[model samples]
Target: MEQGRAQNESAELGGNGHDFRPCQSVNFTVHRVGKQGTKLQELDTPRGLACSDTSCFVVDSGNKRIKVYGRRGVMSGLFSSCQTFSVSNSYWDFPTSWSPQDVAVDSSSADGDHVVYVTDLKEKVVRKFSHSGVYCGVFSDQMLRSPSNIAVDPLNGAVIVTDRESRQVALCKPDGGLIRRFTVPGVPRGVTVSPKTHNILVTVEGVSQPAVYTPEGQAIGESQEHENDVLDHKAADLGDLCVDEEGNIIVADRRNSRILLFDPQRQFVGTLLSRKDGLRDPCGVDLLCDGVVVSDLEQHCLFYVRPGVANTSITKPSQ
Candidate 1:
């Protein structure tokens, strides 16, 4: 049993000289974490990145398919939800068009464990599926338009999708209820969620953009690059983002061909990887178990980094 632990305890002890109260509260404890592996598995679809049931998931743009990898970066299976079936031949239904840019998994599902979610970019909808590549359902709320990226609030399973051309983000319930549509100041590209927090981060191609979000869709942080004529922030065009175990942020600074690590305060810590490290046009990033999985969009290859070990490469979007 844990209670709210007061912050700034020294203020409580010497508050006689001034008006004092607990400024903040912190909770510490253990939790049942889903496992994810960091092994460098073969690569496919170096585009949409998500974690479904503690495993790394990707929508390989080039392959026109999705791939699953376990916590240790073991190849699990290929996503076959979008199948071709003639109405007169097979008993299946699919959207008129299916083009996936990003994928997500519903973390709150209890039925058909490992339920996966993906954005149908061309169809302007979000499609739902099972971990085994079965067509589960579809989310076509009126709010969705050119949906590109998908993220889910693991706590409540709220679905978040980004529409690249529209420069907006849509929030919906797992059952396909439209909650809200948010306008991102810049052209938003990739997006991510922090499991330990409800805050969502989005990458934008706008000049000086970093990430902007609020609990209720308000812009929290503006683009950090090009503050003024004085000094340019010069981080890079952020395309993908992920939070590591230590709550540190890993950003794929695309155009600059580098990846950056930032503290919780959104302050730049350092470059985690770069083109000098054999990264080329690194667009999407997902941190698996103890290693990092990176997608080089231009090269169509997947690269994994392990401590003290050489990085291994796999052909992009393997069939």
Candidate 2:
């Protein structure tokens, strides 16, 4: 594809007063992980994904464990819930049955250690873990019914969680203290914070676009429209999402098997990847320095893609 920026265009503003500019077309090189697995590379129904500067974490939902991988896609470590008991006066070990839904990494500790937060669907709480997989504690509240996705605030280190059953979002302190809670328009699927604006971006089911909110639980803006002519769908089954430093939003359209990009002003830029890119049920997404990481539930793997500036292009889904 030809590589260049489009002609300069006039800036526009959205309902939230965000300055919008023309979006540049880009091409992405996709890489697959866990397709040909080692013992540690095998995954099943992986859901949530989060990354720090040095490592990426995957909530291996089917395996009932959290897998850690280095930037180069090598498995560094893993941890799971375990229980010990005494049977016939002998010690017996068994795995704990817990449903881990999503994960978020907090890299704001003063000691330079990253904290991992995982939402437990079965327990209805958010469990905390150290960078090395040690259980720290958990964040629990009567208001949280089904915590599905989570994110951390870049400005204040607050943990944000979305509950689909409750149809609400909660902002909490680093230690899991509830700061505030507010209801959303629909079932919330994903939650994220823009590193540049600190604005919370959430994907709600039945809503055609991701909703934007202020840190104080005030609704701000939403994408005016979606570029969905290729899919011929009126609404997108949005899953997880993340924002880059430039404030661009990367969203996982699970039902369409595509990843989408939106400018800071919540304007649909273009499709980043689709089913042609070997994505099957892209459920979770996180922004990396080089590109973006996506978790495919149906494929039971992850995709690391390095996107670059190129002539705008969109691929139609295979028949």
Candidate closest to the true structure, highest TM-score: 2
Q: Rate the local accuracy (lDDT) of all candidates.
A: 0.58, 0.70
Query: For model 2, what is the C-alpha lDDT against the true structure?
Result: 0.70
Quick one: how many clashes does candidate 2 have? 0
lDDT of 1 by residue, 1-319 (tens): 1111211211111000111111223221111111122222333346767654336677665444566655322333222222212112232433234566777776566674766787777767787777666766778646776788778877788888888778888888887898888888777877776665667778777543357476478877565755433113453677777764344576787777776666666665555566655666776676543345667776666555432212222222222
Clashing pairs in 1: 36-71, 37-71, 37-72, 39-72, 44-317, 45-60, 45-317, 209-223
Error of 2 at 244 (Å): 0.8
- Quote model 1's TM-score: 0.71
Please, what's the RMSD in Å of model 1? 12.8
Q: What TM-scores do the predictions have?
A: 0.71, 0.79
User: Candidate 2 — which pairs collide?
Assistant: none
Off by over 4 Å in 1: 1-45, 71-97, 110-112, 207-209, 227-235, 309-319
